[model samples]
Target chain A: MSDTTPAVEAGRLDTEALEQVLAAPAARFRHDYLEVRGLRVEFDGFVAVDGVDLTVTQGDLRFLIGPNGAGKTTVVDALTGLVAAAGSAQFGGVDLLGRPSHRIARSGVGRTFQTASVFDELTVLQNLDIAAGARRGPLTLLRRRRSVPPEVEAALETVGLAHVRDLPAGVLAHGQKQWLEIGMLLVQDARLLLLDEPVAGMSQAEREETGLLLQRIGEQRTVVVVEHDMEFLRAFASSVTVLHQGKVLAEGTVAQVQADPRVVEVYLGTGAHGRGSRTAATSTEVE
Target chain B: MSAARPGSARTAVARPDWWRREGVRLWGGIALAVVLLVGVAPAVLSDFRLNLLAKFLCLAMVAVGIGLAWGRGGMLVLGQGVFFGLGGYLMAMHMKLSDAGPGGVPDFMLLYGDGVVPGWWEPLRSPVVTVLAILLLPAGLAAVLGLAVFRRRVRGAYFAILSQALAAAFAILLVGQQKVTGGTNGLNGFRSFFGYDLADPVNKRMLYYIAAGVLVVMVVVVRLLMRSRYGELLVAVRDQENRVRFLGYDPAVVKVVAYAVAAAFAAVGGALFAPVAGIISPADVGVVPSIALLVGVAIGGRATLLGPVLGSIAVSWAETSLSEQFPSFWTYFQGALFIGVVAFLPNGLASLGGALRRRRARGSAVPEVGPASDVRPAAGSAGGVPADPPAGAPDVTTDTVDTAGRHA
Candidate 1:
């Protein structure tokens, strides 16, 4: 776990260095930034995600921490075009709100489910190969893959699953499956990654490795992780957004949000509202 | 496990030993099939039996498409009969036109209609257009339909129902157009096929060879597809469509390609069926025939490359033999066989060898302790099976369990 410290520090420094060096194209970078405004999602009469505004730039290891039903996942869903969203989400100069999910993915956005959804019947290498084949034409897809691409090989090494590359993903351990899903995102060259509870069921060692992996990746890409584990968030998050009941409750560095009075109140309260019971249930589940 | 290390080595340079062995097994399996289909069956069987075998080969062609679509892509395509019928009708029309001579109307039109061919049937007089239409029309229609349905994320039983309805509607449409489609009787008595006399046994043998040759080519094509990157993507789309979508692929497009390919294969099968069976009718391309095709695929092992082909041939042979002996029992027996395969062997008969091997491993070896034991058998037996079985039979079993649990 301590070894992750140097990588995290280096990641921070690299981000600052990139900020200064790429400042000339700062305007261009801002155009490609993920900027969401007044995003709302409704399921029947129930508002799952209320008017939320978020701005995630490159090199952002942004953590979205909230209690259950706080609409953290819903916000991610809206951005990924999984749900119908109102208002505007501009990513890479394209409005992501009404576009289909695949189109959003085509515009360099990728996501992973909490349960680590992977092609279980396919081997790990094949999974990565398929992910790397997004821009491949019909003819290329039809032809047999004569060689494993360098990017996929690199991803396998980075994810520490090179030994099991030939095994079907179905047989992968839970932690390895989550890592494989992340590896898939890497091979896709996704500019924006929205990971939902990636370390939910991982062991401590796996969680530490994941934090280091996220830090390493967050150096160049924008990543928003919807998380429940407070310790993991503290270890890796550069900045945090706290949501309560479909609205943004607070936003700042982990220390800053931890210090925020309203955030503390939400975390501790067992008030008259139904949120008390829900928060209590969820908080008990969070280690 | 000794071979496992090399199999895990980088695919480009190391060229895993398992891969080489798999190639040998694949081509070897095809070679065996070619021998049986082209050489042995024709040589051994009588002329009538050879013709019957030719018809079975035509039907097996449809199964190849089904294997790609339903087996690999996880689409329950229940309307292949529509495409099969399209091909059969197209070929039949061409044959009828040829028999009537250039620019002359078919004899059926003279008898059933007002002695004039409809303009739609006129283009089929040109062999070139007929052939092209036989190949392209069904595929085009399937692509269009696939785009419409898959884009909207319709799948599972709903897709099956929609496809089945298409077959029903097509049959109804043909029945209603009595003058054009020859009512329920449909078109029959194709005396010639591409200038070859159908009555001549030599020409019939040539037709059998043609069907046999086409079936082999199709199997090889499907085998290539199953080994390609597209095959991996198709399986991925089947198991986790939403996940594939996030990987920057339109799952709908992946699905459409497979669906269209399946349609094309079924169409070709139907095209060959017309001349071989000496008829094209609604009965041959309706809800029942479509289900029959599916049953054969299910029984043979839809996922395995040759499973569908073998299953189709076996089922057709059984139908011919059993129906002759006991007509009423064959249908019930087919239903029972489908149920038995789905219940006892969800991966189809192709997976039976793998299953038996696994059982023997479990029984002979010390009782396997945990999840660690699960992967060893799969890795060790990579080139062991002749069907080139897909990975993880246990995974599919669990998938079935999940589906059942969800419904329950």
Candidate 2:
């Protein structure tokens, strides 16, 4: 895998470099930012997520990495209104604490389920079409579904599934299904996207394609990915948030977090030290 | 295994463009319907049979709405009988009052309603208000009910139970209000409709024609609605409700509107049914008929455009004929038929074409029957992973980082 780090800055990248970054997987895209303070999620008195704070900016491809119960997915779920949440979350100027999930989605937030929850029986094109026009209401019942907007067409191309648009989503390969779900987010004009394990079950080549697609999407939208693939993240993530026991343990660039004593202790003791190497190494060698 | 798919590809091109390749079936259906309803029924059948057919047509209207609500919207609306009964009773009351001429209580109302028209019966005295009530009452009830139930996120079988309970309650209330409602014997003996003499054979024929025409119009209207964007949204909600919610749709609103449309359709059917059958009773509006309506929809293929209507008419016709053939056991025959269809043709008769085409491929595959029986909610397991990693799988769960690409 390519080890080149992205030239991530606070503001917009120029168009020439932006286009280049959009083409390459490891390049950064630039400005929707998210700020969270004192976020807590409790289920039946068990604290699933507790007192978490994070700041993320545009094209800020941040990775949330932890063991199974680290509360990474719960944090995303709370922001998307899946699980009950308390405290404050501000994304693109909207307070996203207790609003309904649909409302949060309409407020420009998008999320994907870990199990890849798509309308499996529908054609890929129909899946995107429904999401593309998700805001339609009951009064529009008499009106025919209009033509696919250019955004959907662009998303089809971006996810590289334009040719298979007529195929049912049930038959899609695992990686393609993941991309199609992301394509759904893109079609909804979502500004903030929370992806749950995007690269899981993908082939090595498919992972590379997804990383490039994620980078390309980040140029236009802020993406927060919850993933366990550290070797994949090391090459692609400009920033990383390490979680342990329902709280953020460390937040920094990949090398910085890897060097932190607490992060090393947690990961090493958990026997995850082999997955996330400190320096550039063969991508598949550890696996 | 090597047979070509002839129509699926042409579904997009090289076909009459109106309904796409589906247009062929559409035009054929219209032709068949016209021949059967217009040309053949009046010419061949006696007036008694014709009236029975018209009554079946009215019931088909209810099936149309049920197909959309229960079949597509996934509401499991076992309370449609309540809406149907309400509309029928409203129309029957208006007719009974009108037939009493002026300043007189209806014959049955005099006998059982304590010789006084209830205050609520006064508004239905005008034909325009009666028509409007028939249209709005059920729709309004459904809207209120849908809003309350869906907002609470009650769905699947619980919604079914709630709706069935509503139907039972409605029937019970009608029975208990014997003074106002003619008791369980119900309302009947209408002598006229508006100013027209109901005793006149021509007027009865006209009413029959009206019911047939209304059924046709409703089918067209439902087809238009099904072709629209809302149809796609409805189906999406059915397949993956949470996914639709995350896509920025309130699943409750989508469900409520569909439920309301169903209620409206059932209302109209009931209004016509009272006139054609010359009666409206608690017997017609109870739990039994509600299940009967769904049985037709299930037999016909709930999702197909013409399935519900045709299935309803066929089932009603079979009831008449089979009962004549086996007077004591026809109900059992109907039950057996339903069981056979559910067991063998689960997607309904509409899918027979696809099933025939797939016979070769089917032999090697698991024989799955019935959409109702086949498709189920995704197992509670998320992609086969438990909500939490079980203690047994600690190697994968405790060390997700070390597992690398093996995250569940």
Candidate 3:
């Protein structure tokens, strides 16, 4: 998980991936911080996200949790340039506001949709290849792919999709598809990952696996998860930001957020408290 | 077991399996086509039939471009006639000027207007300038048009209609400028082509060979583009435009490149059509011919490399043979064929092989992801289901379930 880890297999001394990483210093692991100040998004006359401010630095596995229509996704959308917002979202010394989505992505910020949007017609390897090809020149893109980049190969192994590397993405299982999307971000060299409901339709076991995968990925970058599943957040979140009615309600550790009165009121008073599964513990009361 | 997989990645990379299979097939198909067009057709068919075949090859050139733009890039180009007409008219103008000799006015100008060649027509007096204009004009126009349209996010049927409207407008413009464009009569009656006597059978055969060579080269170029990383990106944009953007790609740029390439190909086809068909007119470069070009591509299978070319030639041949006896029925038949292909076989005739293989695999209880035909998803599956839908109702979740089941 650290930057010093060898890019290739442990015993392999020289490989294409190792050589590639060595030749390209920019490919080395580097952390990027995301700073949002007074972020607001309006759909016509209705404000979807209003005056939300947050900061996520290196190794912060911060969770953005809120009830339905509480503007959890709208904040991520504002940061990723999916929606026109009036605020400053600074990432890696570049302002994400007023820029196109692809330009925002080029500035080391990547995001995944609630529904995984991997190309269904391409193979798993081809999906990663496209993500890895952002820096390639036009003439280079015209030539046939002679070899797989080390980062793509590593991402394949990380997502547990090396076995199905050549299979068309459409035939992948639901959990596998989500992992493929994350793996794509990995090869894309995204420093800030804003995942929106990554495990929305996953089974219990798949949820745990995705949580562990996020922890491993968060070790060298800034990670933000927008989740409605409180149980999953409580289990894996190092810190949490609670959004209520288009604004940040609370920001702290899992226990601290649970103890905050304003977050409890927003979750319960909004009549959306019993929307998800609740355990016997009082911490589950947030659900 | 671990050791066994160590070099597997390298093995996969070095094998070039796709190139070995599809590449070999492509080259072999081209060689066979060259043999038939160069050797067999000339020996067996009469000069008149050979000329008609050459004309179809020129039309097939436009289909090649459509295969790239509509088939791979999902642009739904319904205005290729504009590019075709641009190339054809440019070449026709050059031939007319050469026949009139330097400074002498063409017969059309003498008959229709004051005896003076238009300033625009003067530049094409040089064969070099004419060739360059034929090559660049259509592509340049397409590039500008594509950038403006795609950047504003105009696509789907809106893009199609815009292209069709351009074709319609182009035909009207030609008609309005009768003094220059030859109006309804169009441009014809050339005694020679590039200094060779058109009246000579030897020169006519030479033109056929030239058209055949150009078509073969076009197929090769398209094949190379299709196999490159750009090809994958083009299809990626087609299927998921938003996803490609999030991956740090400008979908507009990708679309513009494909559209411009298609335009260039159509232009080349048009230039050839003028010499082979011996005419360049508003009727040939209009809305109906544009649709006719698409019908061939749709029937051939837009997604495949050779599908459009072969399908184009087949459809043109079919029209030549069937339309002569039942001229009225040909239009209805073409329409019906296009409708059936879009409805039942959205991937066109090329996907028939894949569908048959899928069925046989299902029967044998084997999951076969056949590499032979690397066909993308059904073109119809890009957005809507294209079949039956409950009117004005939201079937979002239901549709999701249905698609997931089908994929499984």
Model 3: lDDT equals: 0.83
Q: What is the TM-score of each candidate against the true structure?
A: 0.86, 0.85, 0.86
What is candidate 1's lDDT per residue for A1-287, written digit by digit as tens? 11111211111112232233223433434445788899899999899888888988888899997788999999989998899989899877778988888888988898999898998889989999999999999899999999999778777777777777887877777778888888888788777889999998876777877897788677677889998876677679999998888988999897788778898788523321233243433332331
* Shift of residue B282 alpha carbon in model 2, Å: 0.7
Q: Output per-candidate TM-scores for chain A, rounded to 2 decimals.
A: 0.84, 0.83, 0.84
Interface Cα root-mean-square deviation for all models: 0.6, 1.5, 0.6
For candidate 1, list the clashing residue pairs, or say none: none
Span of 10 residues, lowest total lDDT, candidate 2 chain B: B399-408
Of 2 and 3, the candidate ahead on DockQ is 3
Count of backbone clashes, every candidate in sequence = 0, 2, 0
lDDT (0 to 1) per candidate:
0.83, 0.78, 0.83
Q: How accurate is candidate 1 locally (lDDT)?
A: 0.83
Q: Which numbered prediction scores highest in lDDT against the true structure? A: 1
User: Which model, 1 or 2, shows the larger TM-score?
Assistant: 1
lDDT string, candidate 2, A1-287, tens digits: 01122311112112333243244233322335788999999999999899999888886788888777999999999999988899899897889988988999998899998888888767788889888886655565458856766666767766767777777777777677887898898788778889999988877777776787677666666889998876678768878998888999999998888778898787534334554554433332221
> lDDT per residue, candidate 3, A1-287, as tens digits?
11232222112112233234224343343536788999999999899999999999877899998877889998988888888999788987789998988998998889999999999889999999999998889999899899988888887877777777887887776777888898898789888899988887776777887897787667667899998777788778999998888988899998788777787787743323543545533242244
Which sections of candidate 2 miss by over 4 Å? A1-31, A137-141, A268-272, A275-287, B1-20, B360-408
Off by over 4 Å in 1: A1-32, A268-287, B1-20, B367-408
Worst 10 residues of 1 chain B by lDDT: B399-408
